[model samples]
Target: MQYSQLGRTGATVSRLVLGTMNFGPHTAEDDAFAIMDRALEQGVTFFDTANVYGGKEHRGWTEEIVGRWLARSGRREEIVLATKVFGEMGPGRNDRGLSALNIRRAVDASLRRLQTDHIDLYQMHHVDRSAPWDEIWQAMEVLVAQGKISYVGSSNFAGWHIAQASEAARARHGLGLVSEQSLYNLLSRHVELEVLPAAEHYGLGVIPWSPLAGGKLGGRSEKGVRRQNANTRFDSEGLNDQLGKWEEFCSERDLTPGQAALAWLLHRPGVLGPIIGPRTMEQLDSAIDAVDISLSDEDLAALDEIFPGPGGPAPEAYAW
Candidate 1:
């Protein structure tokens, strides 16, 4: 596994970050533990999760499992742990958003649940449009000062919002966010509009989630016996969206759409890490295969011809 510095931060993380969104809901405890073990064995050191990922749970069981694994395996020091807050966690109105009180409460809860004294990278899951950047940044800055978190970051945040936070941090001389997590994939290149440029300009690392467009590029649905593979998240509703034009693109090139899609992301500049969720070893192998793929200029030209960007480096409001 190749490691890279996480943005301007000195911490080095693996290029492939293991995503724990599937841990408690879609994957069982034993399987999830095995996956983590294999991932660490293969040199993947980054693990990304959120407090609200498992159904409607306030604190997902995934973190608890991971905390236990860290204790049992005695490998906590070897990993770079990342988690997010700012999602709806319960019935109360205060259960969500980036309010200072909630930020304090959430990080404390996350630390307790993870069995850790500090979080390596604590991120706001989304930009709270109602809250000012100062409020959120101050809270995150407080966490860092209190030694509860090693670093701060934002996810699903736009360029303007990130800029505002950075400006706030600069004015206060506080630790600003060093990374931005957003959806980036061959099927969803929306981040190229503003987020990517902002990251580059601001010296922030871009750790993209959904690198495979939720398995649309996993190569499982390709024609022939591969289509029948059960290792994929191939439900009828999702499969409906996966068919037609996209399939035609894959067919014409004689490439599995999944491999082609991931290869495209790996080829992209300024991609710090990609969070890949694989349920089984075979699926994990397929995702790792992306590491070896090198797309040709001809391949990139064809992709550009298929899906054109919004053009040049300018901050545009994206749907993501």
Candidate 2:
């Protein structure tokens, strides 16, 4: 793939981030390794994981599998690795959150599981409403100074939360957040209302997760094979009609619905790329196809009519 700097940072990353949340949970270790090998071979050098992946029973299993892959593949330096914090990792009261102690402890644990000394990008999984942004930044600053993390990022944060964090970092003369991860897709454009604007203002790249709307845009569910994640969104009224129109439009353009959805995000102003969490190698191969899809202006308009966004941004989207 295509390459872009991670937001305004000097560092560069692939447009498609390989998400390993399914490793050891939905995918066998061998399959996970093979997918990773394929991902690297195909130029997908960014890998995203989390400390609390692999469900409650096996919280760090995904990281462990990735660690094994890194050790065996010896390709850690080739990847721009990202992982998250702020999820409950154990029963202890201090096991989670963005508190200084937890941030310190969490990064160490993640590094060990990932088999890497420094994380390319370390992100807070969610905004901790109770934690002071200064306290959080102070912890992140320590990591940066120690060379444990290259950049800081946020996930599932609103516009105001990003502003608050950025201002806090500014006061401390820190680099602040370099990226924002949100649940953005052709079908879900909530971030366009504010998150996208905020990230753009703060020079943060926006990475869209669930870019296929939980596989609703993957087309397999439309072919009589119902995927588990594709059914909920289809039960609603007019969705089938919309999806039918979508599939027809993609067919006319010789593109898969999945490719169309990803292409839509790729065209978005603030989006760097969409996260592709593939459980199988076939899925991995299919996702990479979106990178080459050249969506015309007419194609975007067609997609907009089928899956509308939250208008433009903020008051213009709501008022005048």
Candidate 3:
């Protein structure tokens, strides 16, 4: 696996990060543990997870599972751990958001679950319009001083929001966001017009989620049609039963859909890493292998013809 600096921080992460969104819901605990082991064995040093993914019954045990994997494997130092906050956790009104009170309470809870004193990268999962920038930055800087988190990042934020937060941090708290994470895939190119350029301009490492447009770019297709009936989750948002428009690009180039899709984003400027969460080990292997598939200028030009711009026509599915 290739490694690169996680934004301006000294820490380095694998170009392809092992995402644990499906760990508790889609994958059993044993299987999740095995996935982590296999990924680490394959030189995947970066792991991404969120607090709410394990189901409330486990009380954040998804993070606990990763903690156990580190303990059992004795390879904590070998990996760069990344996780997120700011998702609804319980009935309480304060259970979510970027407010200082919640950020403090959440980090303590995360640390206890992860069995670690310091988090390598702590991320805000969503923007909290309720909290002022000063409040959020103050909490984050406190965590840094307390050794609870090393660096901070933002996810699912727009370019303007990122700029506002950065300006607040630098002008007031003297602590700034080091990276930005957003959805970026062959089917979803919305981030290219603003978010990508903003990250490059501000030196924020860009971590792309759903690099394959969920599984749309990786699934089987024939005659430019994809069988969306295979997964219930795939059947929603007017995207059901449609093959992604990028299929035409892949067919012309004789490349696998997933390869063409991933290769395209890998070439996008300022992308520090791509998050890949596969249900099965075989699927994971295919995602990892995409790094080796190179797309030439002609290939890119042809692909562009299928989905030409930031406001291009929608793809077969929007999940990825």
Q: Which candidate comes out best when scored by TM-score?
A: 2
Give the TM-scores of the predictions, in the order they appear: 0.87, 0.97, 0.88
Instruction: Give the Cα lDDT of each candidate.
Output: 0.79, 0.91, 0.79
Clashes by residue pair, model 1: 217-258
Best by lDDT: 2
lDDT of 3: 0.79
- Weakest ten-residue segment in model 2 by summed lDDT: 226-235
| Order of quality (lDDT) | 2, 3, 1
Worst 10 residues of 3 by lDDT: 311-320
C-alpha RMSD of candidate 1? 4.4
Name the lDDT of candidate 1: 0.79
Candidate 2: stretches off by over 4 Å: 222-226, 230-235
Tens-place lDDT per residue, model 2, 166-242, is 99999998899999999998777888989999999999999999988888777765468734563374357777678
Shift of residue 95 alpha carbon in model 1, Å: 1.9
TM-score computed on alpha carbons, candidate 2: 0.97
* Candidate 1, 70-121: lDDT as tens digits: 8788888899899999987767788799999888888887887788888899
Give the distance in Å from residue 177's predicted Cα in candidate 2 to where it truly belongs: 0.2
RMSD from true fold, candidate 2:
1.4
Candidate 3 — which pairs collide?
213-320, 214-320
Instruction: Give per-residue CA lDDT, model 3, range 203-275, as digits (tens).
Output: 7898888777656776566564554434343345645323445665667668777766777877877998788
- What are the candidates' C-alpha RMSDs? 4.4, 1.4, 4.8
